[model samples]
Target: MSNVEHVTFKNRDMYWEIAADIYYPPNFDESKQYPAIVVAHPIGSCKEQTSGEVYSAQLAEQGFVALAFDASFQGESGGEPRFTEDPSLRVEDFRHVADYLVTLSYVDAGRIGLIGICGGGGYAINAAMTERRYKAIATITGANYGRVLRETEGSAEAVIAKLEEIAAQRTAEAQGADWQVDGGLPESTEQAKELGITDVDILGATEYYKTTRGAKPNGLNKTLRSHMGTAYGWDAFHLAEELLTQPLLVVVGDIQGGFGAYRDGYEIVRRARSTKKELTVVKGWSHYDLYDKDEPVAQAMSKLTPFFTENL
Candidate 1:
């Protein structure tokens, strides 16, 4: 009924082999070239999570070939000091995946596109700024990583102090201490309540990642607090409005959580150089609802199907 297979390829700069699931539409013909899209799961997640697997699977069912993969240091992908969350490396992963995708005879290189979800929306946009290989890009509940997370939690001075602690942890690891992790998303309903998470978007993430609804062992809800500070290092919007030239479709919930409304989706629309861009807001869904919610996912696909077909 489907033609999905596991595959591996090398990252452009990193030595690790990226793990991916490649999906081909039903009645796929090798003799014919089809437009394709690279789908990115959220940060701290993998191909099996809601954004990656479901997005890729459903898109394939609609006739586009889709590739979903883990980032260099996460999930099934090979990398040391697990859960680095390096934005630059993550951006390159998309390029390298595009490299592998273009080599397929049944794929049209010029028609290549990308779909980045949640935090991945930042990476996908980062790639589109100059990758050139991808003609168009879109994101669902896109998050500008540093702005949303760092702003929600701490100040620069406190982050510096935390960075010092991370330095100590790194030294400790080198001295044979075990790698330490911090739960990035809401790990439980009780924890969510304790954190006083009032944002509906964050609540949606709690329902998906922490619960069985979209849970996967590979999509760890935790990250190494020491080395993973890189996740909060830079904001993705700097120069993005001037540098981003490709068509962009920013699909965001009217309300956002850790991925804030103004910082994530609206900021991109406010600052991208993409002349052809549109922002769609799903009325009732929060950021995480688009991950696997029936209505939101279908609403997003309605946009994705046409966006790629017309742009790529």
Candidate 2:
């Protein structure tokens, strides 16, 4: 069984509390200081989903202290304007997790590492850009939400129009109208197809986030409509070419489309200044496969286990 302990701590820059699940290594000893890895969940996901149930659980078994946490404004974390997806705040959440980890006597602060999945991958990279506490960083199916939205929103004019709409929505909310939200995946592949979504990655997201396979009570897959403006204005790898110097490991599926995680993985690795970096492209696997698929997850762990072990 995974030795997980539920905990909560206040955010570094914000008044909200962050809820998290810490997974201890087998034969865990509080008297001993262990290297720690902060695990961040994907956008619209929580600690109880793949981040805690799969990745953190597996990492703990591999002999590292693993932490899976919900970002502020999501899951059990305390934040206002619920379900907002602000990348800047999300990046700051990682720093807050690091702050909490460093205070624990059992965690070796200098040897701290990071692992982020999907959108969390983007945030992790962004966090490591300035937070030098993380000695090494890794991402599975890493996705840059801003880049994806910019490229996929059809055209520059279309994107600008969408942002204008988002602005109007925010004004409406401020004027006492209810907060309109969007970006939730469909309940099933059939529904997704009916909605004109045929991308393999999005279809796979439906399979994972909408079903019992990866679904959790706290992972409802919604984001505030107004938050899209912030997401659209941000970039996860804004200064990675200069500031991202930690050892990097990028794991992604070979699948070509859906949300561009595959593309983002290669792009970030190229942009990062990390001298020691490697990108492992899992053959024949799609973006969502790495989320909870046994074979891909195991395959990713094979690279991840050694990467952290050597770097941290």
Q: Which candidate gets the maximum lDDT versus the true structure?
A: 2
Per-residue lDDT of model 2, residues 109-172, tens digit only = 8999999999999999999999999999999999998988888788899899999999999898
The C-alpha lDDT values of all candidates are 0.83, 0.92
Q: Please give the lDDT score for candidate 1.
A: 0.83
Q: Model 2 has how many clashing residue pairs?
A: 0
Tens digits of per-residue lDDT for model 1 on 88-203?
77888887898899889999998998989988988888878878998998998888877765776579887777778888998999899998987777778678989998767667
RMSDs, each prediction? 1.8, 1.2
TM-score of 2: 0.98
Query: Could you estimate the TM-score for every candidate?
Result: 0.94, 0.98
lDDT, residue 19, model 2: 97
What's the TM for model 1?
A: 0.94
